[model samples]
Target: MTRPLPYFEVSQRLSIKEKVGQLFMPAAFINDSEEEVLRLEKLISEHHIGSICFFHSRASAATNFEGKKEVIHNKNSFGRLKELIKRYRAAAKYPLLIAIDAEWGLAMRIENTPQYPYAITLGAMQNQAELVFEVGKQIGLDCRKAGIHWNLSPVVDINLNPENPVIGYRSFGDDKKQVIEYARAYIEGMYSMDVLNSIKHFPGHGDTAVDSHLGLPTIEKSEPELLQNELYPFTELMKKNIDSVMVGHLAVPALSHGKAESASVSKAIITDFLREKLGWSGLIISDALNMHAVSKKFDRKGTVECAAFEAGNDVLCFADHVEEGIRNILEKGKTAQIEKSFERLWKLKERALSSELVDGHLQQDEELMQNLAKESLSLLKGTFSELEEFRNNGFEYLQIGKQNGLFSELLSNRTNNGPNTLLGIFPKQVKPKDNFGLTDTELQLIGQTLKEKNTVLYLFGNPFVLNLIDWQQAKTVVVAYQDFRSFQENAANHFMGKIEAKGKLPVTLKS
Candidate 1:
């Protein structure tokens, strides 16, 4: 066996075509057909493409919001994913750095895999950074088992705006310090597995109302306020030697010096602020280049890739135009910059590939997830004893939206004819837009039920959804941040006084 050359030596020996290809991290899909896989494989072999970011399928990618295609569910997605990764890795000229949006776990991208709680759920846990770190380590182990090198996760963006369509449930919470703390735990956990992780949506994407996937979202906050709030976590995390910082396609006029360009492509934001002012020397990865916020202007002509590279990004994630991007960067005579980025990328790639694949933490992970679920349940509006008394007094339990089978089974002994009602509301969607996907009828039913009866409301979704309706009339309220089985079972237990609800609301809700 021969020892491989270091990343510096390997990067220095790359051809011009290979150098340009090393900058692109295009999207890969597990559900891709043989033909589709062939197309991507051709790109990998012919174009010298260096990396891939896996999504479940074309329909599930962020660009599929308009329902242009049907989502075909593949039960063997995990098996298919491993095969696809092995194929792509073999196709590449160099060792490919496989990545995914596995913020919560492989479940974020794959169907039949383990899932940890969302960042917001983890954020709500009181003094549970160790649990958050464990979740990250478990997610890393899952990634490694599936042949993934990088997890584009631990979204450090502070969820300052409840109306933020894209990053609401994805973010930790509004408090900057708490967000930094939890993000550190997540990154540290990934580090423990020797797995590469990126602290993302740089400069922050949390406070904006618009979804950057559909259109551009502008942040009007002054630079100082951004530093104090949105940029605080990034600053703190950067200090801890983060592997990479994924810049989002957000328009920060303050950072852009009043220019309208997004943070991902703005040299003022990425180079001037992040690179120079903050003195960050780690790899800078761009958010998906296909997003409407940045791509709409460039028309996928590789202009987005060129601009992103020029702005300071080392990796152009989900770049739609690989050949065009390669040509564009070469045409601009950015050979030196390209080599710098390629060398930087190779360093991380070396670290990513050196790690051993770790597996079989399923049982321990389930226990950790259960502990996180129970710890993260918040008593937002009512006393624990009051809710326990309500459950003991034979209250009529009525579910508003999607039924939790586990919760329903646990509370099967409750009667429907009781004077007090236990209204368990499962919001139709996690995002706050479209009233958290609550239908007019659902809202009307909630209003009518609340006014008509002494109802104890238990919300199992984004806490922001509570602001959409008049939840004030409910006798008592409890917020179980996610609709996972653990949360449902824990909520049922809390209602029965089997457990104590100790979580504080991570974000402040409007009264």
Candidate 2:
């Protein structure tokens, strides 16, 4: 019996076209039509495509900012994903590197999987590295069970700008040290589960106001400033030997030597800065090439893909036109670059495909959620006794924005005509534009209620939403970081003094 050749030796034997084919990691939609699934399989067989990044559907993709297409939710998405993976794996010549954007959990992409708290919520907890590790481990387990090799998650961007349209709720917080510590814990957990993870949106997408999905976001900060704050977390985590680092689409003029090219397609940023300056030799993956930031800039079919390859990305993720991209790479005599990336990618595949799927830890996941909610629910204003007093006095309940059923369940018994008011402010949107999706009517109602009655406020969305209204009037103010059922239940418990609010606000709030 003969043993198979190593990935490097395998790369040496591959033809130039096959090597180029091994660089493209195109998007695979579980909710796609039969034709689409067959198309991907053809790419796998004939094209020898390297890897696949799964999304819920094309319409549900992050680049679908126009909302022109209707996204019908597929309840069977989880099973469909698993079956699709099996089918695709059978079609591939080499083991495919499966990846997903399951930052919070499989629930990030799939409909009915275990969902965990966002990073901002976890950032609110004090001294909870172990808990964060558990969240990562559980998410890794979900990814493995769903036949995913890589979890494109744990966004390490230090969110310094409050009005950042894309990365507000996704980021851990503004502090770099905290982001590094939590990211290290999460990465360690993923390693423990033998699941690959990527710390993403490199150099930092946190302080920019523009949404890269819709348009180009330029980071105008100096190189030193970026190195000090934005690049700090990635720098620290790189030292600990992370699996991969995802290059974002944003432009940094300082790093690009005053040119405003997207970092995802800039050799200066990916190779010079990340690889050489930072001494990072791990696999470098590009954030989706379908994003408007780089997508709209290139008019030709595979111009961006070739540029990304030349820029030093080992894997071209979500490349729009795979065949065109492969042809262009072969045409441009990029055999050396392709072979380099192909070898690195196969090394990743070796580690990724070796892991066995772990079983569900539903009870442990739930307990972790409960513990996180309890520890992260912050008391921004007034005492617990004040809320108790309001409850005792038969407080009138008024929900200002979007309603949460679980939270409203606990407030069902409160009277409408009571002297004290319990105000639940659920902002319709997470982004900071248009007053965090609050209407004038809602603002008016919040002000009138707080001014007229002794109000106890419960804010169940972005903490930045507190800046939109005059919340000081409320006697008791509790910041429940998310509207998840666990948070809602825990906030209700804290309202009744069943649990204490132990969390400090993760992000600073303006009055």
Candidate 3:
């Protein structure tokens, strides 16, 4: 791997083009072809782009799998990422700072990588902040193994809005103190493994009804209200001397002096508020510029770069047009600002990536993951002791999950099956906007299962999923809080008396 150039030398010796290039961190993919590799090389070697934020590219043939695939879940994600980093680094004027939105873990983007439980699961293990810390350290180690320097993670948003489409499960919890506590523990753990992190969606994206990826979400709160709720986490992170903060594509009318501009391109939000008022001296990474919230407004060449740079962003991440943005930034005389931005970025780089990408702490231990999953298993409505009697009665299992894979697989080889063992697994694809309640088909199945035999309702979804059914109608209700394979297995073990259901519901269930 090519080593990073000294901060001052890279800044001083760089040509105007390279200096402007140093401000932009365009999005990159692990699955780029040789032709695409040359295009990235042109951006790196010629444009002198500073960094690349890794996201799964939807560039492959949909018929690559001969099917209609919504998400491009690329296999061998870690290995491909490592190779991509080496190629990009080899072509760069400075060693590219590889970054990712590993909010939960590397598995968020990359398939076949280690995945920890969701933030809500960690929230359930509130007393187990130490475990959260351990997992954070593990995530750091995973990042280093794949040559990732910055993790845009540990989302500190207080998830008070149940309707919040993007941040509901990603946030630690609704309580500000708990959110801060868990975030601090996770940050400390990541630091131990020498991985840098960013406190994301600054000024908080917790209370919005819309997903920022889809459009601009608005948060209408006065400065005091924001300081108490939305701004609380960032304040705490800043106190902890956080290395980076990612401003989200949000419209805070009050924060921006009643202007509708999103936080990422709002001077009143980033400069007057985050920088001067809050006194954040570290790097400011704008939320991905390609998102519709920002991109729709700034569609012309270099509009986003001009607005974001002038708005006081230190790094323009996932820019729509890197070459156009670089030229626009230089044309607008922001090269003077580039020096300061580069200095802050370089200082972060020197501390974060100076060491070899090897931290021997908790390297993807399955035992730890199982333990975490088990610890996070919340049998909210039913008791473990009740399972024995229910299983003896030959009860039907009604599973409401996003998919039919895991629970179906578990049922296929059931050893204690009886004639009355009716199994109904509803495969409802659960995303932020999807109904948290049961579908008509699911309701009918549950009704039938309930009447025929003692039905055990095991929901592998949001805690709010309980609202979909008269949970009291079932003989037993098991809430796993998530539908991950390990979580499902752990929940089953808890039911079978192999493990005690150690998790408690993190959020309050709707009546």
Which candidate comes out best when scored by TM-score?
1
**TM-score to true structure, per model:** 0.97, 0.95, 0.89
User: Which runs in model 3 stand beyond 4 Å of their true positions?
Assistant: 59-74, 333-336, 359-363, 384-389, 400-430, 436-440, 447-454
Candidate 3, 303-397: lDDT as tens digits: 88778988999899888688778777777755667778878887787887688886343246777777778777776665666777766655444
**Clash pairs, model 1 backbone:** none
Give me the runs in candidate 1 sitting further than 4 Å from their true place: 1-4, 359-364
> What tens digits encode model 2's per-residue C-alpha lDDT throughout 1-511?
1122478678668777877887789999878999999989998999888889898888878888468898868877788888999899889876677889988888888887778888888888888899899988888877877878899978999978877888988988987888988888888887888889899999899999899987889989998899999999989888875888999999999999899999999999999999999999889999999999999999999899989988999899999888888887788746667777877787877777665665543333667888989989999898867777777878767787786677878757656567887788889977776888899888988888888889889998888888777888889889998888888999888887888999988887663
lDDT of 1 at 258: 97
Question: Best candidate per lDDT, number?
Answer: 1
Sorted by TM-score (best first), the order is 1, 2, 3
User: lDDT for each of the candidates?
Assistant: 0.85, 0.85, 0.76
Model 2 residue 346 distance off true place after TM-score fit, in angstroms: 1.1
Per-candidate RMSD vs. true structure? 1.7, 2.3, 3.7
